[model samples]
Target chain A: MLIKKGAEANLYLKEWHGRKVILKHRIPKKYRLKIIDEQIRQYRTLHEPQLMHKAKQAGVPTPTIFMVDTANTTIIMEYIEGKQVKLILNELTKKERISLCKKIGRLIGKLHRNGIIHGDLTTSNMILTPTGKIFFLDFGLGEFSKELEAMGVDLHLMKRALQSTHFKFADECFKAVLNGYMETFGQETEKVLEKIREIERRGRYIAERKEKP
Target chain B: MEYCLGIESTADDFSVGIASFEGEILANIIDAFISETGGIHPREAAQHHSQVAGKVLAEAFKKAKIKPKEIKVVAFSQGPGLGPCLRTGATVARALASYLGVPLVGVNHCVAHIEIGKLITGAKDPVTLYVSGGNTIVSAFDAGRYRVFGETLDIAVGNCLDVFARTAGLRQREGMPFGAIIEKLAEKGSRFVPLPYSVKGMDLSFSGLLTAAIELLKREEYSLEDIAFSLQETVFAMLTEVTERALAHTEKKEVLLTGGVAANKRLQEMLRRIAEEHNARFCVVPKQYALDNGAMIAWTGVLAYKHGQTVPIERSFVKLRWRLDEVDVPWVKE
Candidate 1:
């Protein structure tokens, strides 16, 4: 199997039914007691697919699982032959990046409308294939929650990623993403955005204050 | 005999367990604890999982005196844990399970705790107090399934302990989990300032309780120990009260303590005493199985495997909201 190791899961390129697919295998750690790990794997193996289905309903692109080998803790999904949004973001001329950023933003907005929060929202997790479609991948750390704080963090994650990765034109890219996000989230976006500011303020306050000032 | 290896990495401790089709525990190993840098950084924890996960799995098999080929199933805690930590275990389990040509099972970390409680208690049917670093709840087996009766409205019990410890300038993510440290500090401390007791019907809120404690300590320069003492007292009492109510509502004669909080001896004592007072049986799993771990998954996997329930690789998904009630009981449903 052609395998690429991720920080958490091992990604393998596999062919099933004459079509290529990506297999995300959650490897087991021996450091922990046995019973605990079994429970976690069982829950997650099922959780990821449900998220994908939900995302699909929300108009996001995700690979369909061809097979789930729970005994192996592996999820085999349809593979997209495209560059990651991370790599593509670089290849995009400013206008393209802004355009793609708008699309990403809209996708995130759609996700929010469905009451789903993408736990880790880095550009690298997005894929832009030759078909020019945006496919959001990896829901290993995702959960279903309606909390505004959770939703704010989800947007904040993208903001941080854009700032850190595309500092050259972060403001523009962020604005584009925000516009797209507003397409669906509309008014709720304002609330989460405001909450995001508050969250940042709280974080900064905690960091600065030493001994009660 | 074919076996399924399970791993749990949703939080501070890492757990490994192997189960056979015969319902036997082949091996269960837990790496003590990893210190969090400056605190528990999600990325850092994920990085740690990437580094040692492979070796950890190898060691589990090595200790069990079993070969990877002998294993036919694998499972890991999927959620209700730290995203980074959960990813670490999830990635590892998926990879190894693939290599071994086995079915991968994604078990909810909380549900796994409860299942382990059921196994240890032999209660067959009982009310459950599932408390851990990531969750605090009163649950009961209903209609042949485990269902949530009451839970923390906000902030899990363990999160309260960790957040408080971090605020008090106490070492965060110490050698043991911060919960154990808080318990110990509570034992040594005396001053009990009035802390907020937020018990709304069956639901509880530790976040507010934690805020009150932090606010109190800030208002009156108090030692970390006293704050920890009061926080534990306020939160544990809140939990016990809800559990008692769950027991009464469900009318279950048995109560099992599961999850990381079950590891706390004082909490166990309180639960046992309450159960005894009601003339009900109280069962607590050994400390090893209390926290997020793999054995519970393996044990549950055996039941799933026996029922000839194999999730096709094509239809597999990780459930972020996987509720145990949705799953039919391992044997009875079939």
Candidate 2:
């Protein structure tokens, strides 16, 4: 077992007779009330992964579950050995980047069509397995929402991440992503996107004003 | 078993991860745009993600050593982030999953980071400080969600660092994003121009600090580095205060510092001091996990999987305005 220690949980790389799996165990604290801590741990242990599963059923990409151990606050399942999408993008050509982004946009549009909001959307949470596949992970914060405000924030976060990381070709890259999104969302999603932009602009303006005084 | 593979493109770079039960990181590919000689150009970022997202995912599966038949789920970042970038990641995850006879799960990137931290550190109830370009806040695991106890009413700490990094003429793409160069300059130039320090109970404000720094720069009132130094200090201090408060409020003993800005040694040190003072331990994922990577997503995927949670293919879609509070918690484990 390969144990990875976190602040609140203990993760173990559990392997069984030629089988490989990872186990995350949320350890208890000696300082807190057992009831409260257990409640939090229990809720998270069940709530998060279920959200991931629900997102999967909704057509968003996530991982499959195998076992849940609330007593030890551990989750055990398959372990994929691959690279992150961030690294994969680094290796792609410019033209390839555009084509791929458009496809991504359409996928996001589909998510909105299904009313699934991925609360925290950033590139860091994505994966690019070697065989031309994309996966979404971490639905601990996933939720169901018909409200555009939530969706607006979701898209806004993506734009912000792009601008921050792809400082050079952010605009073009975003355009392609938008292309993909529009493909599935239809033109009606434009208004929602526009509103998101306004919110983002407001945020940028606030930050911009602070930079100078 | 239903599997949900996660693809994150909500930013310049593209990333993908497969989350089974505990999450086996299949791919963590990243593509950065080297500006000829400028700072973050939004238009450019969008184009880049648009271009490379597909190849990245292809590579992700390859790295995982898995075939499409071996997978059962596809997860993509929905939103609560940049639209274009989010769309790029979301759209790709959506399309491929649709073709694979797999279910799609839309993930929140912010929560992904935190969940990864949780997966890596196992911090079940630790306070989370999500310091990033678009967000700056002190968060806590509460009521089945990571609640925002304190956040910037204006700009985010990472964004603040990025703007100064640009103005300071630091290397935009390659270096430590912006915090490193800016913070280093901040070290020598010690003339402190009192920046805005707003901490109204749990809420904080970073715009005021950025504004002060901008004014000083425009006025040429002091050396740029000095102003940068002050800003970093003031902003980091603001974050430390709020984090400390969250710890206190939640009575949580540990602090998990995730996000791009978490890479800053100075910020880490300052936060460590606060944690030490409070007798709370602090956990900051290594740079790979800290800045942004599929490992975090894959790691968080493990937790999500165990709950018997799965998103339907046709119903699955991207959310431009996803919020942490909106996700429903259903635990089959307990």
DockQ of 2: 0.03
lDDT of 1 at B275: 79
Indicate the worst ten consecutive residues by lDDT in candidate 1 chain A.
A204-213
In the range B151-233, model 2's lDDT, one tens digit per residue, is: 66567778777776666566755754566677678778767666655554355666667767778888986998778877876
Cα TM-score per model: 0.59, 0.59
CAPRI-wise, candidate 2 is incorrect
Q: Which has the greatest DockQ?
A: 2
| Chain A accuracy as TM-score for every candidate | 0.89, 0.76
What DockQ results for candidate 1? 0.01
